[model samples]
Target: MPGMVGRVPTSAAAVPGARSAHGTASAILGHPWGGTALGPPDSWDPAVRAVVDLVLSSPVPMALAYGDQLVLLYNDGYAELIGDRHPAAIGRPAAEVFVDVWHLPGVGDVLERTYRQGESVLEKEAVLPVDRRDGHAAEQATFTRGHSPVRDSAGRVVGVLTVAAQTTQVTNHLESLSDFAAALAGTLTLDDVARVALRYALDAFDADRVAFAVDDPGGWRTVRRVRGELLDEADERLPPLWRRVSGDSTAPLAVTARSGVPIFTPDGQPMREHAVDRHDQKVRALASVPLRSAVVRGGLAVGYHQAHPWSAAERALLSASAELVGQATERARRFETQHGTAQLLQRSMLPEHLPDLPRLRIAARYDPGVDGNAAGGDFYDAFLLPTGGLGVVLGDVAGHDVQAAARMGQVRAALRALALADPRPDAVLTGLDRLVASLGAEAGTHELFVTVVFGVIDADRRSITLASAGHPAPLLRRSAPGQPRAEYLDLPTGAPLGLGCRPRTATMAFAPGDTLLLFSDGVVERRQQSLSVGLARLADVVAEATSGDPRALCAVATAAVAGATEDDVAVLAVEYAVRPSRSAAMEMPAEPTAPSRVRHWMTEQLTEWQVPETIVGAAVLCTSELTTNALLHAGTAARVEIDLSAERLLVSVSDSGTRGTVTRAQTDTLSSRGRGLGLIEQLSDAWGTDPTVRGSTVWFEILLPAG
Candidate 1:
């Protein structure tokens, strides 16, 4: 350990008494190789003797391959280097000894160059396949080997002398550090960094304990270890002896902290009192390395319950590894601070209030492509326009990031303001296009653009007029309960905003119980399928709706392709219906008690509507039956709405369950249920059940006789 690994000499074997006072290779001196092709040990030439003398007594791993056949000779250190192949390879030919590594690129070539050309060669980080092999174990080892020529007294090359140092420990250290850095790259807390560092270091070193301790809020905390196992960080406690050591400047941790060097106690004598996991047991070895950093100064400690040969190389590695823990801790602290600010900024840009309107139901959702949305471009909003119409807008600005998100916020805010002021679908879109074009016209701007489907629904006219600015067509669910399947509004659309183009209005009838689905491309676009396939899939979902509940419809449509997207998805589903106002509606929890609450609500609503007493009980009975079926069959949050008008009085129950069918159940007098639908049919002027994308709604309209 004290002497340097000396350079190779020009000759060996010719010297008398090539003594091997060693640990491992001493057995080679009396080996059975004297009867082999390498010849008798006493007959070796002077050049071979000189090199063998140089290697036999050396402290480091060294080997010499002499003569034209390159027979192998190694020292005690090199015997351990060959693993299980030591004594057998003492005087074997080099080619046979290196059979596994001979074919590797430049493996034997480097030695050949030194032996033939009389030049010296140095190879750092060389990988060789020659550790051990007795049919059970063989491992790859990394080495830094030096190859130099061995020549006779006349200066003619006689052999090749090689010096090798196994670098697998250093390689493992660097690899473990790389893994630790990757694990902590996204960490936003000190606890996460500390846990990863301690656990990974303990595993990498195969030690009993590994810890990073600092003077913190409570006390010095170390990652606890017991029987070669690491303690969970959540349940970790301060080491029982650490409090005593923290006050002593002569402690290993304190000494390393002040000196910035690794302090090692290979023998257990000095550490017996401070060792063990709160058990007062003795440890075989212990080490503490200082962490010098620009953030906070700390130290990394490692301990072993078994005797381990501590080396300077290992101490140097531990010192460098401690610095990485400091870097990760600082990085996590910075990330947490930056991420919080980004969330506040994003929330401030989106809509907080959605208009509550009668004769219309709206549901909108926005998801960022990335967590915390450093920047995302998808946006949606629902608001009351100035012209007494409901305006629903959904759009996606091109690109992603804080810059794109900022541009999206600007465009979204501007679109909402313009729509609330005008309400004409075409007029608002035209204004938005001009605004985007003008914003980009400013010199040296990257032409930012947006695609949008802006629409206004007028309950009075029972129509929804839409303008698509190079966006996907809105799916229109115009089919009545028993009519044909729903279809998309296949209207001619125009260019996106900032393209210096105008868009024309595309209007379609939005009847009572009809729905219009607006969404960003992220919903219907996928890497595995074409846009047309996604469009067809969307069409199928929309075509299945037979009710006008916005939330239910949104659930069904989004469920088809929710978590499979890479881009952020924004959906705005608007269903045109006589959605009762607060005064005309009452919502209760969907449970066993819902039927009674709903019956009571029906009694109150009918009284307010001044319905003739003769039919009030029948209406209440029908409402109870429908509400019970919705809660039991759909397992959805249910709502019942009653709208009383001059033409007819409408009572409807809707739920959010996406599966199940509305069927006419045959019943006898013995049954407790199944009579509700029959009663609804017998009692009302017109009653029908419509099954929407997510769930079904059953409504009965009693025509009011002309006065």
Candidate 2:
């Protein structure tokens, strides 16, 4: 009656009627539609009556719209499917009843074609607007719908019947699961796994909050995202958004993680007493699933701010997602273990620290390939020679594996031994060449080869002698008055180390305020780029650099060339400063009086060097704090070294203990044990820590007043 748009009879009693219908058809007959389009069901044509009986008898969701008005009629199943549109929609037109979505291509067009052309149509995964009945906005529903043309007794098309089966939940879950697996496949570390899994879970599960945790030896490492924002923690020892929960805690996440059991709370009121945060108190539903794996144990928790009925399908999806996360966590754990071991082995093969010499500032950097799980063969070293000159070498073996790392270690050890014995660049290379040849012969492989550049710097003569074994030429940056230039040395190249070939030495003037850069091929080798082009690019970048500081130059060069290198990179830079640094060292015992003794010795040394009293006092106080920290926390004997230059005074305290780098204690300001770092931060211009092979070094620099 609401959508009657065609000519209608004045009264149902005036027409010759068909047999009486029943059920929904009986209701249509009882309606006050005598003056409406269809008049009454008892007065309808026989064909329309028969189709109505067929549609009403079926249990599947089915509906029909008849005649030119396309007036709607549906069974009880379809009545429930349309949500609140129920009986009111029964006699209305399809377009008026489904006003929000009747014009969608998959709905009105398909029905129109079926009614007009008498064609039957089937659409898979058709999208329709649906009311969720949860006081929220309407959501999209997916269904597989079939439409058939209803014909009259005269063989003319009369109406269209549509049968729909909802598939929204299944389709959405399957797609989300597939994408989750693909995302997890690229994760390689615990942090990466946590990030990917948590974000995906929050989106896929439609939860207000999500958390991920992994069991570690120290405690449980946890990350949480609440309402699209990752929670921040104040602990500087852990990574960002990561908190360490005690393993024995009674928290839901911890309980599930330890017992490998899932905990589901549909009504979270009972658990509100144990809430840890305001969000937790407001949670109306939650699901915590254990990440069960042979290599790692963890948990994932999802929370909702409104009440939710834990449906069976939802539970099954949650379990499946947990399984995927567990597998990814295990894989990441194994990769991290292997990567850590490989990196440790590789670093152990290189020098622990560069030689801290006067008049020469040296710095080196090494990075593994993109796949860091495999070891690389790049190595570098700098040591004091017996002839009072400095020997620096950077080399690369031909392969990337354990054997390559071993050979690199052997070659590096032998080169240092050879250089200390002769101190001549050419002699060192010739000896290294023979050793490599013997190694190759023993391994029964002609592929074992190395490319290296060795240089000897004589500070007294202001000169450097260089020799090469099929390595890239070294770049020299000369900083003269109003004239700064950078160029590569044209040294004669020989065959790589495993081949028996003679090497020639080239001499060049290494003036003060000039820097020399030595590097492996990875630094200058890019895909689809020529070596000469890369070298020229490096020269231009070096010329544009403002300072001659070896550390700054190394940083710039590595940042410029190694941003996306597939191979390992190694860079070494040495700068001859304008004025040579004067340095001294003393070893102190790990006793209570170490700090006092360090203070007195430092004051005496600075006084002997004619350092200003204010600068000397500051240096002594900062050095004392660093030395105290080393002894208190490291519990090992410490080595104190001081380097005095025209612009700054640098002091370092080294110990052979395994304690990690120290940070200023945020909560323990009053405690004497942790105050040393805070004092160092306030008193020094720059201060930091470096992890060494066996221990660590804590150093600070104080800038001097203008001369």
Candidate 3:
């Protein structure tokens, strides 16, 4: 009876002058608290009374559960949340009153931690099922709840206080905005931006249709997506087509893009007045936000098929999304412009084509770094020396910029000039070192240095003399019977070019069917790996190559690495092989008598080479047919080259035409245009056509009679 509130004498109250309570507070004061763990109101501890007073005085939804049984007490603000269970719920156990959702993760766990461990918990967007009080089923409510422990005079936690705020709509909007930002961050081009923006807008805005448009040089580029389709039919290109829109266009997207204004219309009348097509006419409402950027102007528009009133929150989200897209578009445009110019400058400094020397098959390749937006300093060159030997060089400057490209051009020109003046490998490198030092002195920066490997190939000696100036060792791949061998050349390594030092040259036997590979550090450098490991990998990959051809070797070396390189890569490969024992070339004009002239020229040359008369006749006939075809189909000047090896005769006719490789299927016996190819294929021992960078080459090989 002492714990019961109704049995407490009116004259024996704790707070004698305290004002009369109201609402849930009044209910708490008059309820029967007999069997509850909290006992009666008059017999309750001062700590419990203080916490109850605090919960009832707050304006926000708050509740307090006290003692071991966890009796529930709340204010008028919290009573609305419990529906019809409030008056009878007062002074009752929380687990009994809210049995449906008390065991949920954030609900009961948060209260238990605060009560038993004296820990505070803040739970966001928690779902709780509460009675509807309208005779309908219970509805789930979302709330952000905070739980704090209540302490007594002895510094021990006695109860748990809970304060909650409904945040369903706010949480949804924040999540949507965050997702939109994340999606836009990965876009790298205008097409990417448009695709991501249109797709996200359709789902986030819940609109029937979404359109993203940007101002282009000629007109406007737009991409649209409907709710159920991937993209509009007319805009299916990877980068959608650009449609010209005049300044006076009445389309909502165009107007906002041009004027940098946002337009929102809830009624269909305004949309009808400015409708540009059938799609616009079907839109009942629209919201257009302008993309605010210093470099490019654009706009985004969301359309609804049914009437929809745009809320302030929705409008703000649209504006923010547009801003993100605008910034990304600007960045992509800048990168494209810079990358194009950098590539052009880097390529213009390199050799257009390698020298075509006898007994020396040469091939070179250049690839930019992963960041293609900047110019790199890697370079390669090959030319015929005055001494009749081949001069080849591969080098890298210390930076990636316009200045580095200019320096690369300077070093390349100087090396060629020095090699021509004095064809010695060491002398060429020494001269280059002086030039590099002078360049660094002029630029007033010691950072201007270069690594280069200069080599001279002497065909008669069957040897290549190489000198290095702080560059990676050149690789030598030997072609054996069943096992090929690859090893790095061991030469005296000198200081880099800027710091002058005497370079020593080493000559190695470059026998027939052997290849020499010169590459930059980019070809053998990787993240988190030692340089020796990369070098070993390169050697292994090169040794396993199927052929010793220079072209195939270059391709295999670059592809040996698995991913994009951090630095530019340059590779130059030279293969020593059995070339023509005797050769001659003649150029004929694209005239009616060109084939006659070529036939007579070929007959005289083959006769001088002491080719058998029968062989000469067949060779002259095939040469005539190839020359005729080149003039008729190519309509350009043709080059006739004839090479006589120890056991075969090679004839090739090249023309500077755009016609690709001529296949056997194209050589119909009935057509006058292809009769020559058919005849050559039948008469020659072996014949084929190859597509060159500029045009095509049709050649045939005839085996000589045995001695």
Among the numbered candidates, top TM-score falls to 2
lDDT of 1: 0.66
Candidate 3, residues 1-707, lDDT tens digits: the string is 00101111122121222323225667777778877777777877788788888877776667888776678887665665565665677888777776766776666666777889999887766665655535666555567778888887787888888886666556666788788778777766666677778878888888887888788654566667767653432223223322345556677888899899999988675568755456667888899889999889889999988889988878898898899888878887887688668877888888877887767878777778867778889999999988889999999997888999999999999999999999998998899999999999998988997999999988889898999999998999997767989999998888899787689999999888789999999999988888898899899999987556666567678877666678988899998865535778999786767788888888888898899998999888888878867765565688998877655677889887622122222222213333465667667776655434345577777878867
For residues 1-707, write the lDDT of model 2, one tens digit per residue: 11111111122311223112123455554567655566676787898788888776766667878777788887655555676665577677787876666666666777788888999988777666676556677666677788888878888888888887677768899899999999999988777788788878888888888888789675676777778563333112222244556779777888888899998988766337556568777888888888877778889898899887888888888889888999999998889889878888998998887887768999777778767788889999999988889999999997789998998999999999999899888898999989988998898888887999999999999999999999999999998778678989989988888788689999999999889999888888888888787788788888777566665566567766534677888889998988988889999876667788889999999999999998888888778777766754565688999887776787888888633222223112212333566667678766656545666677777777869
Local distance difference test, candidate 3: 0.76
Better of 2 and 3 by lDDT: 2
lDDT of every model, 2 decimals: 0.66, 0.77, 0.76
Predicted model with the maximum lDDT: 2
The RMSD of every model to the true structure, in order and in angstroms, is 16.6, 10.5, 16.9
List the candidate numbers ranked by lDDT, top first: 2, 3, 1
Q: After superposition, how far is residue 1 of candidate 1 from its true place, in Å?
A: 26
Residue-wise C-alpha lDDT for candidate 1, range 471-583, written one tens digit per residue: 88888776464663557796667999878658888777888767788888888888877888887887787676434455545655665553477677777888666445333
Compute each candidate's TM-score over C-alphas. 0.52, 0.69, 0.55
Show the colliding residue pairs in model 2.
none
**Least well predicted 10-residue stretch by lDDT in candidate 3:** 1-10
